[model samples]
Target: MVTIKDIAREADVSPSTVSRVLSNKKDFFNPATAAKVRKIAKKLGYRKNTLAANLVKKKNNIIVVVISSVETNFSDQIIKGIQSEAQGIGYDIMYMYTHTTNEEEHKHILETLISRQISGILFVSVILEKENITLLDAAKIPYIFVSIKPDNEHMVIGSDDQEIGYLATKYLINLGHKIIGLAGVDAYPYAGFSRIKGYQRALDEFGIEANEKYIFYGDYSYNSGSQAIKYYHENFSSLTGIVAASDSCATGILNYAYDHKIKIPEEYSIITIDGTNLCNITRPRLTSVTQNFRKMGSLGVRKLIKLMEGKVNTKNKSIFVPVKIDVRSSTARLTR
Candidate 1:
């Protein structure tokens, strides 16, 4: 609770002299005088106001991690990566969830962080409006988008989802899965649509007809995956392979087939994206295209730091984390 005035009054010096001594601004005060001020300040149990100091210095070592929601495993992994990297650099991180739609809440959070002198922001799977982006620009607060790229041009860190899709399809193709079905996403964020595009491209490249009926649209959930499989069973009865938008979707398909007495890898070969830990616990471990969530999270924080430090300009930067397929027990060469 002790202010510079209190320290100065007790030390019998000007507030400016006390400030200089506390800030370690040498050559402005005699060594003995500075020492005496420090000794008195220590005796008074003085604690420095970090917020005020940061306001005066025009910088802070705090980074705000703004997420739309934390319901997914991907979000947890990304946060871990962000925390690890931030701690290594002697920076502190604070979490703020916007829930993706609450504009007023998001604005209030931004204002609070700005007032508290936050140095940078890391948006995880959250999109910003043009007005919000403009506001951050005007306030001179550096921000980096993580997980998914925003519509506006800004610094972003995410996976090459289209490439991930293509790779998943290609893997199925290499295993001779000619009638490969797609359990697609029916929501926004380019990951779903891009992966569908990659699936179609892989089919086209392999000289196989990409059947529209085989592509079932669903949200990224276990029920959606189950529904897709049900649709596949009812319509594309001959479909022997499937590429899902997420691990949960793939798990859905696996669960449905198990309950219905259908065999996997023998009757159906399945693969999914976002190869999180869900791949391991399935009856037959799922074959998955793994996204480097940790690496993406770490790289995103690093990019944000660089932007905050003025080491990188905010001129449409993009960091694409790569993806790879992990062949497991669920997918096999289609003998049919």
Candidate 2:
């Protein structure tokens, strides 16, 4: 609660003198005077405000982490990793979240972190608007974006979702399910496009005709998954296997199938894109692609810290985390 004014008033010195002493500005203060000032400051429990100190020293050692939605398991793991690594390094973290429709998130983020004390920013699967991204580039603050798609012009850390799509489709194909359905978004922020591309590439390699009707585009939510399934059941009678872009989507398919009296593998099989515990707890465990959430989180934090410290150059800034497909009960050997 003590301000610099209070520290100066108690120390019986001018505010500028106190500033010079605390900042160790040897050009202005003698060793004896600096020592006395330090002694008095310690006695009064006086601490420098990070923002104030950073203005003079030009470094603050604080990081900001922003997520689009913590509503899902994936975002939570990123936060956990960031928080853990940040705590270890003694850096303060300012966390923020944005809504799906909040167009003003950029202004708020800028206002919150533009100070000298804010050394770096980490965006966990959150997209910045065009104007705001331009602002971020101009600000000279070190940053790392996660789960969020890169404009390919900024520093972004995320998984190779295209590979995930490829793996999921290839897995289904290997199991003799040539009629595998693809489900994911078709929008910006890259996950949708990259994942879908992976799926298409896999099918192309196998020389299978990709039925465009079997590919359902959704908003990457549970409800969308359900809707996709309902559409497929009504329209695509030949579909025997499905690959949902996310575990949430996969769960939706599983629930729909369960209530509709469809036998798993006996009738159809399903796979999802994430390896959360939700897979195991389902009526039949879901075979899913694991994106290593904890690693993603930790990597985001570590990258932000390094950029904050100016330890790395940002000329080429792309970090790709790998993915793994966990075989489980939901995806069984497709039966004719």
Residue 319 deviation, candidate 2, in Å? 2.1
lDDT score, candidate 1, position 126: 76
lDDT of 2 by residue, 1-336 (tens): 766677778777788988888876777867876777788788888877876656767666677777776234567677787777777687788787775335597677676577544777887777676777677778877777787555777766778878888999999999988888886554554777788788889999999887788789876677777887888888878888888877777778878888998777666778888787778888788888887887888888877777766787655677788888888887777667
TM-score of 2: 0.81
lDDT tens per residue, model 1, 167-264: 98899899988888888464555566677788889999989987777778876778878888888877776788889877878888999999988899
- What TM-score, over all chains together, does every model reach? 0.80, 0.81
Runs in model 1 deviating more than 4 A are 1-60, 100-112
Global CA lDDT computed for model 1: 0.82
Q: Model 2 off-target regions past 4 Å? A: 1-61, 99-104, 115-117
Of candidate 2, the 10-residue stretch with the lowest lDDT total is: 68-77
